[model samples]
Target: MARLTNSMFPSIPSFTDRFFGGNLMDWNNWNFAGIDSTLPAVNVKESDSDFKIEVAAPGLKKSDFKLNYDKGRLTISSEKSDEKSEKNGKEVTRREFSYQSFQRSFTIPDDIVNADKISAKYKDGILHVTLPKREEAKVKTVKEIKVS
Candidate 1:
């Protein structure tokens, strides 16, 4: 008689691993491996006037990032890659350069409008997204006019 063994995990890749890396363990898909360094972190804050978002992407230029807004959704994405070496130097030891990409998206609140007017800035490894509230969304200070 022969005994058979089964693996606890299926041979097929998990849905999360296929889309998000296996090492990434969170609701948000963020993986920091096989590249220069870890991916940038993102922070979002909201106020009565507007919503602010910031991402920390080190060693990345402003040109590397792409921002898109459509149907009340905003997406930020970037891809990084290293070229293969042609010349042999000192019996090449270890290589770390590899293809890595990061993507994140956020939904625009219904209270906000005019996404086209949104502004963004990238400086010192930090990306800032400013979503200004529309006139109607802003707080109002009404004054009654005196009538004679």
Candidate 2:
């Protein structure tokens, strides 16, 4: 029950029950902040010979991504520019797409003898990295000889 003010000749009671009061603003805020983020996926694979890494980033060109290597740290980053133009008195009504960037880095182990020989390629919405292993890392065979 809600108490009414005596200043007015007649007091008006709130139509809502105290136990069932609704705050739509709070609900809206909870939903907005609790929403999950949608980000691209990445895949990595390695063998005794080489390592392969692929990242899924659609609608991005090769020029949008930059790679840098310093002190055994490999960094990959992507950035995009917004598109805004009005030509010949044309009116645009709606815009729904959003553009954001991300960067990732990894520490290359000392066992990787030749980091300069690494290569990368971007095609079909996927970025691929190839890191070849050093010759010393390969397996070898030994023959046994018997002495009489």
Candidate 3:
């Protein structure tokens, strides 16, 4: 049971609770839902030779990305900040500044991955990271012999 301001009445909802959307208890019926998201989407794919990862992040430059591999962990992070100012004859006019950052990490298998050969590149609006597999870990072709 929710604690109400009126001790005499427990069935009625507060003014703010009913005004926002419906009952505060019902989150599903709220006016704004599923609108909170800051992290970019990522896709991972594996093949016989290597693993590929793609991050969907638009409006970011290649220089904004930072990647690190340590102790079987691959960390992908990015931080970008910019400031814009418009001045008119030594007088302050308009200025704006924005900062955005995000980090994502993946656990890599040390025995199968070639850490030194891992590479990444940013193209269009996607960041692609390649994790090459070791020779022993790669899938091998099957051999078959006919029997009479």
Every model's Cα RMSD, please?
8.3, 13.2, 8.2
lDDT of 2 by residue, 70-136 (tens): 7667777898867665455576655455567878776767476357778999999999988777888
Predicted model with the maximum TM-score: 3
The lDDT for every candidate, in the order shown, is 0.74, 0.67, 0.82
Could you give candidate 1's per-residue lDDT for residues 13-105 as a string of tens digits? 554444444344574554443333455677899877788899988778888889998877889999979856544676755555777678889
Between candidates 2 and 3, which one is better according to TM-score? 3
Candidate 2 clash pair list: none
Candidate 3 lDDT tens digits, 1-148: 3432645665665554445434667865543312334477888999999999998888999999999988778899999889999999998799999988889899978888998899999999899999999999999999898898
| TM-score, cand. 3 | 0.72
Of the candidates numbered 2 and 3, which has the greater lDDT value?
A: 3
Candidate 1: 10-residue stretch with minimal lDDT: 1-10
